[model samples]
Target: MATINVRRDVKDSFYRYKMPRLLSKVEGKGNGIKTVVPNMTEIARALSRPPSYPTKYFGCELGAQVKCDDKNERYIVNGEHDAERLQTILDGFISKFVLCASCRNPETDIIIKNDDILMDCKACGAQNMADMRHKLSTYIVKNPPAQASKNQRKQRKAATAQTNELGGGFENEEGGSDDDIISQRINKEAAGLSMESKLAQEDWSEDTSEAAVAQRMRELSVKGVAAFAEDDDEGGESKYELFGAWLDEQDNNTISDDDIIAKAEELDVYGKYKACQVLVQCIFDESIAAQIPKRANLLRKFVTEEKHQKAALGGLERLVGLEYKDALMKKVPGILMKLYDVEIIEDDVFIKWGEKPSKKYVAKDVSKAVKKAAQPFLEWIENASEEEDSD
Candidate 1:
């Protein structure tokens, strides 16, 4: 994960929302979150850009520019300092001189003077740039980009495999994107169009062709999804305005049946595993299966999946059978037990080195992921509670 760099708009945007995400990976997930308070001098250097220096200055003097010195200047981004905010800001970056691996604390007494890096840690005193460089470089080298992911791993493997690979992106087949068009043309001819498209061929537009079809139901009403989904199971019709609002059906809150089938066929674009939860949840009626593709058709035709298997089954849990229920339920118990009803845990938390323990009960962020994953089950339990009350 690349660290988030300086971006002013940190309001409701991703910077604020995903900060905890980044924080969790480094501190929350990795080795129980080693919180290194960034050395203050490095923090200041990072938040405020380093003063630009001349080109030749790079060999001997450029080092001085980034290092804390009379010339290096303490961080006063837009002219103020709140060390915590500065910390959150730096969470967005991958590489910069501001990062120090030996010491993670931002408030470290180590500040670079004109000729050297001086440490406040009792064991290490002042050290020259060459020494700091050697130490920091070793750590950086060992760190393996600090944010390796599956994509990065694959790219790394591919890079090593081929000598002709350029700039470390993926190797590709020659025909470019047009190959997709040719393949699709053959697929369309090979697989005949169903009644829905044959009937509504004139109404369909070319604009949303590239739009991901699986997510269409999330935008539509359940009733609409079902009506469009069921071929033989039809009565009421839907005024489906492709990218439109939830249909206004006067009789019921549940969406119309037509939209369900339309949305179900849309499921064909993605793999079954990826589409199942969303497709299951968005389905309003089962009768529309006659018109929809395979899984949606299966759902439309069968509704007796009645083993109370709806536990974490998205919205359409009532219709999906025991096999799905058994598989899904097994995974939920441990996650629920791990995160649910747990107010606090006694793992080490980062407070200022000498700043005394904060009330341990107050830091709720440590358990956020477990709580987030637990949300649907929590809602299910609440709904069950309501039903029990009504009973």
Candidate 2:
């Protein structure tokens, strides 16, 4: 069995055109017991989203069981007979038909078989298949079914395999055909590139100059970066465009370095939440934290993102914990007081480092710099506790 990700555009086409046609065929030809095909739209939708998201692909029991589509008809279980046609159907899907990302092939005859972890590949008769996994993940990434490479298409159309000068003969390596070897190599290269893309693009070399950052900061400060709250649309992207105009004001050296920080300050206030996020993110490239606000205006957005927010807080704590420990501790109470009064959804969101709470502790320690903005948050947590426990 194989799984492939269809490009979003290809997916849209299938939903808008191909799938409807397939559905029509099914509807028109139904006699008594309808042999219904799985809804490609439902499959595509499930596969397109993130894993933890609601209504996403939990897993597929498809291709694992050899069963008939007709629920009414008493169909005989015929895994072997269906395998070839199912493979052909899935091949058609990878060609133009939209397919699910989780083991898409209809020919797949895998079974749970009492919680067995190992998937013994019925097609190649291989166990513990790393190569097969690579093939599946690679197919899922490519999405919109691509034209078979020119060389591959030629090989497929070829009647017989003949030896080439470079030892890529028709008979190729042990057991597999030349086409199979080519496909494997192509898959390997594609997988490597895919991995490279997924990695966060951070350039944290100590030697890199902060010139670009300073210049951009100057632009943002002057033009004023936009900062729209997530809940507040203000007709979308109002924050980023203002900052972009500021960036456009400078070409190479149109702005002077002496006033760059000043310019960045001006841009900081009006930037969009999304743009502001990027501006703060730019510190990874430009370590000149002095170019931006001493106060973390950017920290407001940290509450929304689960992973990045944790990274942001932990990194800041590690940084400030060592450098300005005495000053941070002095200001901690005030900050927590302020934070407690603010609209934080979770009380523990303001928790700081160096303090260990009980294993089942809920709210953060109240007297911290982070909580100075809202001290009432602690009281709110206590009040909410009763409601939560009752539920």
Candidate 3:
């Protein structure tokens, strides 16, 4: 299937994170004309969003009624709409709900918390408020995400179990039911309890002392950077899986240089070029252009040899080219310049990465876009080197 970038505003032909080009089929005569989106499910999966969102959004934007039949996998907007018009409307939906407000990355989860909608970015770990003014917010609130729906089912099941237990057919010695016996017992106990005893039962004071905190940390078994216990006893996890798990446990915005280094060392993957690749992808976010300079010393520890530099570049390729393509593709040159200035990455590294697009790190198209974005910076490096030789 032909695909285009999710963010239609991105003009880069090689941009990653693409969804199927919207296909609309208009059916029926003039008065009863309706547009059907046959591939809404595929598009929604690519956007990491629900298909109903875009379908309903089309109705809201065009002031037309929309029908979303999930079981049948059919989405219809009431009108004779063309593909171009629907695609343009989809772009608006992506901007307002799909992309993270802070980092502009589309890897976000739409959550309804306390009747308000929020977009939680997997890349930046920022919880941004979604536009509540939009009419779709009401629909989203009424029908929360699948995770929330599952939680609700669990709650209902628990409640049913409790009801079954209390309303069971067990008869007491006095011929009363479990519910009646339990109610009478509760009333008797409440009459007998003193105010001081009730107060003791209601004690909610937490143990916040230093010793208590130390005990909690010990129980967590903090061994360097591993959040939970190692899977060595489980006996199937590879070293790379272990490293990946540790990285997954970390919060991108707050992970410090010391923790990254300590964890890498503890895992005995400190000097491995592959480790550098994993580190760069997991630690950096859309703010990577600014973060590169700040973490120059840390990056230097990993990006020493040309091979390590290449691995680091691969990480960046996946991060910017694929993860945050729309937001970071244009900033590739400045990011490369920052790395060069900080001495973490050399001129040769840029030249080598820009020589050709490789599918080693990201999709071929995405790699091409990133390399293409670095052209201006690569040219400047060559010009500077020529001037130095002349001097």
Q: Each model's number of backbone clashes? A: 41, 44, 0
- Cα RMSD of all models vs. native, in order, equals 21.9, 20.7, 21.8
Error of 2 at 251 (Å): 14
User: Cα lDDT of all candidates, in order?
Assistant: 0.30, 0.33, 0.75
Q: How big is the positional error of residue 94 in model 2, measured in Å on the Cα after superposition?
A: 12
Report the alpha-carbon TM-score of model 3 versus the true structure: 0.40
Compared with the true structure, model 1 gives a TM-score of 0.20
Q: After superposition, how far is residue 176 of candidate 1 from its true place, in Å?
A: 38
Runs in model 1 lying further than 4 Å from the true structure: 1-134, 141-323, 326-331, 334-391
Q: After superposition, how far is residue 173 of candidate 1 from its true place, in Å?
A: 47
lDDT of 2 by residue, 1-391 (tens): 1233232223322121121121100111112112222233333333322111111111111232223322221111222223334334433433222222233211112222223222333223343312223323333344322233567436423412221223443542222234544544565677798878876475656443598778777556444423332332344444444444544455423444324334444544322234433333233212223322332322432232333333443433322343455544344344434433432123344433223332211224322343342334445555554455555
lDDT of 2: 0.33
Q: Mind giving the per-residue lDDT tens digits that candidate 3 earns over 269-325?
A: 666777777878877888988788667767765664678788888988988977888
**Candidate 3 residue pairs in clash (backbone atoms < 3 Å):** none
Please identify which of the two predictions, 1 or 2, would achieve the higher lDDT against the true structure: 2
What is the total number of backbone clashes in candidate 1? 41
